[model samples]
Target: MKVEWKGVMPAVTTKFNEDDTLDLIMFAKNIRAQIDAGVHGIVLGGSLGEASTLLAEEKNVLIRETVQLSEGKIPVVMTIAEQATKVAIAAASDAHENGADALMILPPMRYKSTDIETVQYFKDIASSTDLPIMIYNNPVDYKIEVTVDMFEELLELDNITAVKESTRDIINIGRLRNRFGERLSILTGVDPLALESLFMGADGWVAGLVCAFPEETVAIYELAKAGRPKEATEIYRWFLPLLELDISPQLVQNIKLAEVATGIGTETVRKPRLNLSGDERKRVLKVIEEGLKTRPILPDYKSF
Candidate 1:
């Protein structure tokens, strides 16, 4: 299963039971929707998936289950966000052993590593496993940006195939293309900026809001690629309010609530992160309700 490194690869929410246990039932349901909607791949244990709270064993469970659920129809990519290089390497190995088709790796968590160190960390992990990697270059959230110059150093590793471009800099996409050409694939990580990124030549979207709005997300991607910018913009405009939810700090809870409204998930979050309440919940619900109320009838994107 070679990772194409393009198309909608969702950083799906990790479903949890009331007791905070993994809820495979709900998890599988959402994944089924993604596959049915024609997504290219599924990313597990990412920020939206609450990677920090997930145990290594639990991450392995997610990888194995996604591998089974996708049934070879799509790639299963596990996220590696460990703080220690050794631990990150181990996690990458575990993901490979657990049937993950690829990995989305973050820079050294908590500690801001220097350029030399960051490049080496990524190289070390890529060397440790044969699995292809999509570097998550989100300096906005992670405080460590994989700059274009740094990527020049990383390009030596064939397994370093793609990047989850979340820098929020629209120009960075062009810069990457200018530098690497097609040697490295670029996927937008920001929900709000997805279409813009795609039209600017991004290869795919590592989406967040797609966790709940799989069909709409895939429709936007397909429409954009099909040269139907008008149709894609129409859906993207309607999806803007809901997509904004993915940019917040409470994205996990926000998307889970969207999942509940969309009838594919529950709002059961782990401790230290409670469900949205009071005006906050009301505000978020208002956005979801409005989006649903005005949900457009999508064109036959695949026909394009």
Candidate 2:
């Protein structure tokens, strides 16, 4: 399945049992929901999927399961975030062998590498795999920014074809479009900026909140891209609060809780991480509940 690299591709969360084990049944249900809702693709083991806590074998399960469930309906792109180049290469290799169609990768985790090292890191990984890559650039959270100049250097690699642009600077989206033109498929990584980015000519959205509100997320992207700005704005305004959750530190818990509220999945998170609680729990729930209470009737759009 060759990824079109346009439209809504969810950075989906990994569902777990109460024992903190991978719940393949429940996980499959979630993936099915996204595809059924008309998402263009699905991304696994991303930041929202708790890649840091996931074991090596666990990621393989996600990649293989997503591949089987999707059954070529949508491309299943696995994310690779590791500290060492060799480990990232091995992980990328494992994803490819297990049938991932593409990869959404971050710079070397923990230690912030220089621009030269960053470029080399991507080059080495791309050299190892035939799968196309979407460079995950979230400098605000990840600390290392893949500047346009670095991207200029990276353009030497043909397979480094897309970008998960999360710079949080909307101007940079335009910058990328103006700089690279069709050479790069820019997918907005920040949920709150989805509408703005799409309007700014981003090719697609790699979304987080879509885990809980798949249809609404897809609606916003389609409506905007279809040039129905008014209809898209109506939905985007209603979705802004819930979308804000994706940018928070407790994003995993927040999104999972929203999933539970939406009857899609559980709020159970792997340890070192816990479910939302106290005032924060109430606060998040209030936003989700309010949105549900007045859930807008989405305008009709063609299905993928």
Candidate 3:
């Protein structure tokens, strides 16, 4: 299936059993819910999916399971968040082998690479796989910014086809559009900035909160893309508090907690990462509960 690299592609959280094993059953249920909610694609093993902590074998399971569950209903894209060029390339190959339709790759983690090194890292990975790539550009979190000029250098790679624009600098969206035009599909990576980015011509949203509130997320994207910004804004306003949770440092825990509240998945995370607790737990749950209590009626989004 050819992914258009457009619409609400949730950076889905990886569901795990209490023993820290991959819960394929609950994971499939989450993917099915997102598909039923009309998401354009599903991205696995991203930051939201806790890629940093997962073993390579675990990631393969996620990629394969997502592909099997999606069953061609939507594209299943796995993330490559490795710190080394060789590991990233190997991951791309493995994802392709496991039937991932595409990949969302971040710049090298841990050691910050210079502009040239960053470009080369992406080049090496792109050369290793035929699957389409979405350049995950969350400089705020990842600490390596893929500047517009750097992107100009990367334009030579054909498979490096899309950008997950999470710079938080809204101006960069226009800069990317003005520079790349249609050469790169620009998908907004920041949940709070989804409306603004789409309004400013972002091609789609690689959303975080969509994991829990899939329908609202897709509705916002559809409404905005269909030129119904007024209607979209109404929902965005109602959804902002829940959306803000995606930007937090504890986004994975927060989103998974929301998932538990919504009956889509569990809140169990791997070690070094604990479930939300005490005041933070109550605070986050209150926000999700309030939103659930007043969950806005979403418009019927027409799927492609």
Which prediction has the highest TM-score against the true structure? Answer: 1
lDDT of 1 by residue, 1-304 (tens): 9889999999999999998899999999999999999999999988645889988999999899999999999999999998899999999989999999999999999999999999999999999988999999999998999999999989899899899999999999999999999999999999999999999999999999998999999999999998899999999999999999999999999999999999999999987889999999999999999988999998887676
lDDT tens string, model 3, 1-304? 7879999999899888988899988999989999998999999887645788899899998888888888888899988888789988898899999999999999998999999999999999998888899998988887999999999988899888899999999999899989989998999998888999999999999988899999999999899988888999999999999999999889999999899888998999987888888999999999999999999887666752
lDDT string for model 2 (71-174, tens) is 89989999999999999999999999999999998998999999999999999999999899999999998899999999998889988999999999999998
Q: What is the lDDT of residue 264 in candidate 1?
A: 94
Angstrom error of the Cα, residue 250, model 1: value is 0.4
Clash count of each predicted structure? 0, 0, 0
- List runs of model 1 lying over 4 Å from the truth: none
* Minimal lDDT window, size 10, model 3: 295-304
Cα lDDT computed for each candidate against the true fold: 0.93, 0.91, 0.90
lDDT for predicted candidate 3 compared with the true structure: 0.90
Q: Could you tell me which 10 consecutive residues in candidate 1 have the lowest summed lDDT?
A: 46-55
lDDT of the structure predicted as candidate 1: 0.93
